[model samples]
Target: MKFPNPHYPNLRYPNRRYWYVPILSALLLLLNGGVNLALMRPLTDVPASMDKLRFHLDDAVFSLFFLLAAAVFAGAFSVLRRERGYLYLSFFSLMASQQFFWEWDGKHLLFGDFPVLPAESLAVKSGMTFAAFLFFRYLQGTNRRLTDRIFIYSAGGVWAMSVISSISPLASPLLPFLSGALLAIVLAYLLLAAGRFAHRFRRYPEDSELRLIVNGFAVFAILILPDVGKDVLQVLTGQRLGYLPVFWEACLEDTFPWALMQLIFVFGLLFFRRYMRVLEQNREAHAEIRTQHESLKQEVAIRQHMDRLLDALSGSYRLKDLEHTLVAEGRRLFEPHSFHWIPYNRKARSIDNSIDNPGLDSGELRELEELLFAADHGLVPGEILPGSKFAPVFIGVMGREELYAAISPKGRPLLERERFALQLLAKYGALFLDYYAMMEKRISELERYHGEQPWVGKLFMQMAEKERKRLASDLHDEVLQELLAARRWLEGSGSADDPMPAPERMRLALDNAEFMIRETCAELMPSFLSEHGVIHAVLKLADKMRVRADFQLEVRTGTLAAKLDDDLSLTVYRIVQELLNNAWKHSGAARVGLDMDQEAGEIVIRYADDGKGMDAEAAGMSPDRFGLRGLNERVRLMGGSASIDTRPDEGFRAECRLPLKRTATAPA
Candidate 1:
């Protein structure tokens, strides 16, 4: 069975051209031939005695050259395992044989004067023959199994023959020929093996090439074997072997092997040409396929991203609930753990309060807001995380707006794809946000217009309630006190003895009138609000509440010497007064706390009660209890915001932030 080529279904390497391999091989062969010629020239003039030979540089130079050649071949075999292993192994074997010749030069130098030592002569001959056998096996592509064995066995035989032949002069003369004959047998094995394999597998191209190369090798061996055999037969017959003739024959010995080596070279050249053609075809197909695949992948990715953007935008609307929905959609689509919606205040050139997705730290939220404010109406994809970290994505605004979404754990700066998608998302988001502002502005204008409406009875009717509270304060401060004073005078005037005492009768009439006044005043505005500003009003109201209403009050105000507008001053004073009344009347509590402060250009009123604060949602629905609504409306009229912070049994806290601007002009 044939082994499959390991580099089968060959693909060309884009980085390296195929022609380099064959060109490199050709250069190496030329270098080998040049070195051989340079070395061979000096050997011709060498004396018979090695010691008598003139100093020539060829021996030392050639030894180093072959050592380098061995190293080169070893490296080359490793790189081109499929094509050059056999060739490189042959080159290494050749180097070893040539090196042996120089190392054992005593036989050549002694010649007939000392006589060629049978051992040395046989050893050198065995090396040459083994090297030739390895080369032939390499060319036939059958060196893997028998090459090392051939080298070892051939060397052993030479060693044994040298020992046996040295015992008799006749056998000593025959040693060289015996070594040559043995080497011929190794070559014959290669040639015959190649021929047998090829005959059985002629349809295989490699087999056919092996057959042709082996035939060339066998023919060379056949020519040299007879010449060598004849010389050995003469020694066995006791015939004299002449030195001059044998030395001369060595000069002619290289021709047959050299000619056969040329034939193997031709086969290598053809194989390389066929491989180059196959490699070229593979390269062209690979390039075309890779280009198509890349284009398709890019196209698909771009389309999918566009689709996601369109889907997000199409579902967006201007309602607050819809804004929330949009944020959720963005988080899901982008896979961000947190999302932000910040309104761009164009006039302020700033961003408003940000609504954030859950699980976000305060600093992260602040950072996102800052990035949104910095953007100039295009996808910023601004980086917020450290240069080395990935956690925040600061998506820029759309079209020079203050709106930006800082997506956390989605990482920043956003990738190019993410930037594009965010731009699309922001464009649609800006539209919805702008619409919400427009609707909110119109509603605000309507509310403000209605508050200033002259039709008092059709209005909130909170004025009637206000009038009642003012009356109650007047009764408590003036009429009720006077009536109590009169009663004290009557008691001091001995009212206990007389049923009709004048002072006592007058005090009773005064008390009835005072009682009637108190009842009527409770229907009007609280007098505390009219008597003082918001902070003073809240404090006085807290003082009026009984110990049954648990209460604590804290009030902070600005030192602004300028007086505020009548409408605004009245609004703040009434709202806090009404909230206090509700806390005292409804919340069955032991304590209530009222805190008022000015911060960030707004007055903040906070009212808290420890009493059973009603369910916020349920209380909000009560038409009878419109105090909270009234407070909200009052703050809105003053261009402020109000938030109720409360839960059942936990108590209630109302926080109001009102933008207070001092009136520049009073009516002259």
Candidate 2:
């Protein structure tokens, strides 16, 4: 049975591409086999002469060929993507050293390229040799056997001794002894780091691929050992082993190691292929189950968003006075375990009634409230508790600045959908609360203005209505009559302009006078006010005056919204007009801003000036500035409030909040 190996994440499913590992291992075996064959060629040829020609040819050909093949194998191993950290590194080092041995021997000693190749070349060769040793040293950690460590240290010691022997003339005669000692030490260490470590490391749970690699290296080392030993024996004893030169003898001796290497490589292929086949079958069987799991999660998220949407719609209010109902309904829909509507009293350092979560202890509520207030911009419980087992999923601003907290009932972390639904609920709740609060303020202002100064309020309303009728009549009578007379005179004068009657042409003169009056009428008040209602009138005025202004004015209006009484509409228009007049005369502003938005049967008109404002005394002086005083009174009479915000040198802003229901009347 092929069990799942958590150690190999990518290999959880069978992959046909994995066949490359086996194929490459087989090729490496062929290279080693060829190397052995070449080494033995000289051994069989002659007696007493120790097969010198064959031996030399085999050494030259096999060493170069094996080195190149080893390099290719190492490259292939590096690409395996499985168990690569140490296994690939070991193969790379072994391949690199083989190349070094070939090049250094050929150029400096065998080919006699120079006395000792060059100082730089010699140093480079030494560095490569040391690098190979160091890789095996580090690789010891992946393979647990104590023998791997002994192998690394012993090989390192031999290389150090060889260096000492090479550089000193007094030690030059010890070259053979030094070379034999190093070779012997390496063979012994390889037997241990590879052999002993191979068996011990294989005990790691479920990592068969790693075990196969370890076993393969150990087998190779074991197979090559006798060959190396025979060579060392021949050199130390100054006697040929059999019909072979010392090097050639080593090659013949390697027959068993090379054959065993091939066997181990074949075993590795068979085992991995079998394991991969089983892995593929398991994946195919379970694929549908995994897909269903993912689909269910997605469905749950969709349902959550739908729930939030339904709650929002059900709680929305159509009347301005019912905004508080909208808020309450929204709260009920979200089913927040805890809920609080905190008032932002900027004067007090703390939020009021800020706790919104239900059933929490007082201390917990306070803690959650503090965290909510401390949040930057907005806060989500999950973000605050990050990885904590108990964190809230959603936080919201309830009033103008207070936050609403919701913790999931089951104590599970809040999913993304739940958090989003809560956030939407919170946002809508805040908006409705803001509207309700504004309504209350306007009501208070209306009561004060109507109660304390009833006559003043009434007079302000009469003046606004009179101003609208006066401006309308002026356009309809004086301006229209003059323009009509001018048109008729112009038509009758025609081409001659009564030149025959008089050189001054009395008819044409009358037309010019009428035309000027018509232009003046348009400049004073646009006709849309009486024709299309306040919204359209405001838009038309912005358009007509846009060209004359220094900066652009953006006029935006919401949908048809609730209709307002003529008196209320007149108040809005007059308030906007007064603000624009102030901006033009006192503000020195570059742009005029105006916006009208309606929600819950209420209309809000805002106007801002982007220029310097007057002194504080002038800003607050209602008695001195009758326009401001008059604008305030007109809004109050219509059950609304007018607020002027200005700072000296910055600019001035004015807003009029009006209740739509109180002003609902058929258009005049």
The alpha-carbon RMSD values of the candidates against the true structure, listed in the order shown, are 21.5, 16.7
**What lDDT tens digits, residue by residue, belong to model 1 across residues 267-295?**
44434543565567679889989988986
Model 2 lDDT per residue over 594-660, tens place: 8888866667888887788766777774455666777776677677767778888878887888887
Q: Residue 386's C-alpha lDDT in candidate 1?
A: 36
The alpha-carbon deviation from the true structure for residue 44 of candidate 1, after best TM-score superposition, in angstroms, is 14
Cα misplacement distance, residue 186 of candidate 1 (Å): 2.4
Clash pairs of candidate 2?
223-257, 337-358, 338-356, 338-357, 338-358, 339-356, 339-357, 340-356
Clashes per candidate (backbone, < 3 Å): 26, 8
- Give the runs in model 2 whose Cα sits over 4 Å from its true position: 1-225, 242-315, 318-521, 524-625, 628-668
